[model samples]
Target: MRLYTIETGFFKLDGGAMFGVVPKSLWQRTNPADERNLCTWTNRLLLIEDGNQLILVDTAIGDKQDEKFFSHYFLHGDATLDGSLAKYGFHRDDITDVILTHLHFDHCGGAIKRDGERLLPAFKNARFWSNEKHWEWAINPNPREKASFLRDNILPIQESGQLHFIKDGEPFSPNIDIRYAYGHTESMMLPQICYQGKTILYMADLLPSVGHIPLPYVMGYDVRPLTTMEERQHYWQEIVDNEYILFLEHDPINACCTLQHTEKGVRLKETFRLEDMFG
Candidate 1:
């Protein structure tokens, strides 16, 4: 099995929103903010190459949104979903499975594309995967998260008859297991992948960056901040115990990291690029 890091570009978000309840004085040290207090973040996706199945985890914000809608996020960078796939000598059509961590625009936007007036699946041949629980929550989103669950990024998959649901705790692939977390959004599935005698947990908003390893660094965007805290506590233990390599999704610089049980609590031990480990 081979894993590839797919760079879909970077965007800016309010640092205060990214680090919930945490003071800017603290979080800014790790994720420095701009003049407007917006921190730059990468929309990093993961590609799994195993046998004939090429599974992609989370599509970054696609280029379908109008200029007015995009101006708020400050989407800047040269990396794109299609370009990144081509970098690996692959294409959107080559993907057999597209696993959406959640229905958030940043994570699933690239799953669909705007074709003139109609929205369509970006990966024509890939079976898009999203859990039924999340699919329902996103479609009928609450006022707080309604903005993140853009219909243009989600509805087309089901409309195209290529959408499938993976049950919680089920194996999505021979070496990949699904684990659900409810804090970030209802039933956000994090893929636990086994590769080369090690396990790598795809940190899909669960732990957005190494800076978020601390228990109190939960994101303000989470629907249930306390639930997020509890989930982090539980997962951090497993992460430290198993020495799992955390594949960060939004970290602009670091791609993967490991944790150590420090006197205070679990903290980042080391950060490295994915190729450094897989190569």
Candidate 2:
């Protein structure tokens, strides 16, 4: 099996929102904010190539939104979904499966695209994979998360007849296993993979960056902040004990990292690019 890091580009978000209760004095040291108090973050996706299967983990925010809608996020960067795929000699049409971690706009927006007046599945030939629980929650989103779960970014896969759900205890692929966390959003699916004699856990919002390694650095966007803390406690220890590599989705600089049992609980042991490990 081979894994490739697909960088869709970067966008900015209020640093305060990204790092829940953590003070700017603390988080700014690591994720320094711009004059507007917004911190730039990368929308990094993962691609898996195994035998006859070519699977994409997540799609970053797409270009379908109006300029007024995008003005708030300040999306900037040269990399794009199609460009990143072509970098690995692959294309959206080459993807056989698309595993959505959650239906948040920034994560799943690229799954669909704007074609004239119709919104459609961006990967027409691929089966879009999402859990049943998340699927239901996103379609009928609560007020707290309604903005993040845009109907344009979702619903199209189901309408296109290409949506599939991963059942509990059911394996999606021989080398991949689905791990769920409810704090970030209902049943957010984290893809854990066994590759190159090491395990890589895709940290989708559960742990956005190395700066969020501390126990209290949960995102303000999380619906259940306390549950997020609990989930982090469990995963942090497990990652350290088993020496697992964490594949970060929104970290601006680091694509992957490892944790260790430090004097101050689990802390970042090392940070490096995914290509540094597999390329």
Candidate 3:
């Protein structure tokens, strides 16, 4: 099996929203904000090449949105989804599966593209994977999350007849297991991949960055903040016990990290690029 880090690009979000109740004095020390208090974050995706199946986890915000819509996020970076795939000698058509952890615009917007007046699946030949629960929640989003779940980023997969769901505890592949967390959004799926003699968990929103490892650092964007805290407590132990390598999705700098048990609680032990571990 082979793995590659697909960086789509970076965008900015209000630091206060990302860190929830954590004070600026603390989070800012790690993820320093710009003049407008917006912190830069990377939309990092994961690509898995096992045998003939090429699976991609999450597609960053695409270039389909209008300039007015994009101005708010301040999307800026050199990386792109297609460019990143080409870097690994692949193309959009090469992907067999696209596992959308959730339907938030930043995470799944690139799954579809604007072609004339029609919206189409970006990966023409891939099966778009999203759970039944999350699928329903996103399509009929509540007021709190409606803005993040853009119809342009979703709806097209199901319309294209390429949508599929993997139940909790189900295996997406021989080496990949699906774990569901309801804290961030309803039934947000996190892929637990066993690779290179280590288990790597895709920390999709569940733990956006190493700075969020602390129990109280839950994001204000989460629908259920208390649920998020409980979920974090449950997973932090497993992360420490199994010594899992956490593949961060939105961390601006770090790509991966391992956890260590400290007197306070589980904290980041070491950080490195994914290649450093596999190469």
Candidate 4:
């Protein structure tokens, strides 16, 4: 089994929103903000190459949104989903499975594409995976999260008859296991993989970056902030105990990180590129 890091691109989000109630004075040190208070973040995705299956975890924000819609988030960087796939001698068509961490636009936007006047699945051969409960929650979104769950980036997968769900505690692949967290969103799936003699947990939005390692540094966008903190506390201890590597989705600079139990709490021990570990 092998893993590849897929770089979709970078975009800006309000630092305050990303760090929740954590004051700018603290989070700004790690994720410095621009003049407009927007912090740059990368849509880093994971591609699992295990035997016949090539599974992609979380597609980044696709380029289908109009200029007005994109102006809100300053999308930058030359890296694109296609370009990154090509770098590894792969293409969208090669992906056999797509595991959406949740239905958020940034996480699943690239799952679908604009084909002339029709919206279609980007990876024609891939089965887009999203749990039934989260699927229902996303389609009938609450007022707070309605904006994040864009219908254009979603509905098309079901319309195309390619949508699949990972049952609770079910095995996704020979080496991958599905772990669910509800703080960020209902039934947010985090793929935990046993690769290269190490355990790697995909930290979707439950833990965005190394900077968000602190217990109270939960994102404001989470529907249940307290639950997020509780989840973090539970996961942090387990990660430290087992020495698991975390695959960060939104960290601009770091691809993977490990945690250590420190006096303050479980803090980031080291951050490195994915290749450094497997290659």
The top-ranked prediction according to lDDT is 4
Each prediction's total of clashing residue pairs, residues at least 3 apart in sequence or on different chains, is 0, 0, 0, 0
Question: lDDT per residue, candidate 3, 61-137, as tens digits?
Answer: 88899999999999998998889999999999999999999999989998998999999999999999999899999
Model 1: colliding residue pairs: none
Return the lDDT, model 2, position 100.
Answer: 96
| C-alpha local distance difference test of each model | 0.93, 0.93, 0.94, 0.94
List residue ranges in candidate 3 displaced over 4 A: none
* Per-residue lDDT of model 1, residues 150-211, tens digit only: 98888889999999999876799789999989999999999999999999999899999988
Task: Tell me the spans in candidate 1 whose CA falls farther than 4 Å from its real position.
Answer: none
Cα TM-score per model:
0.99, 0.99, 0.99, 0.99
How does candidate 3 score on lDDT?
A: 0.94
- For model 4 the local lDDT of residue 115 reads 85
Off by over 4 Å in 4: none
- Candidate 2 has a TM-score of 0.99
CA shift of 232, model 2, Å: 0.6
Residue 157, candidate 3: Cα error in Å is 1.0
Worst 10 residues of 3 by lDDT: 164-173
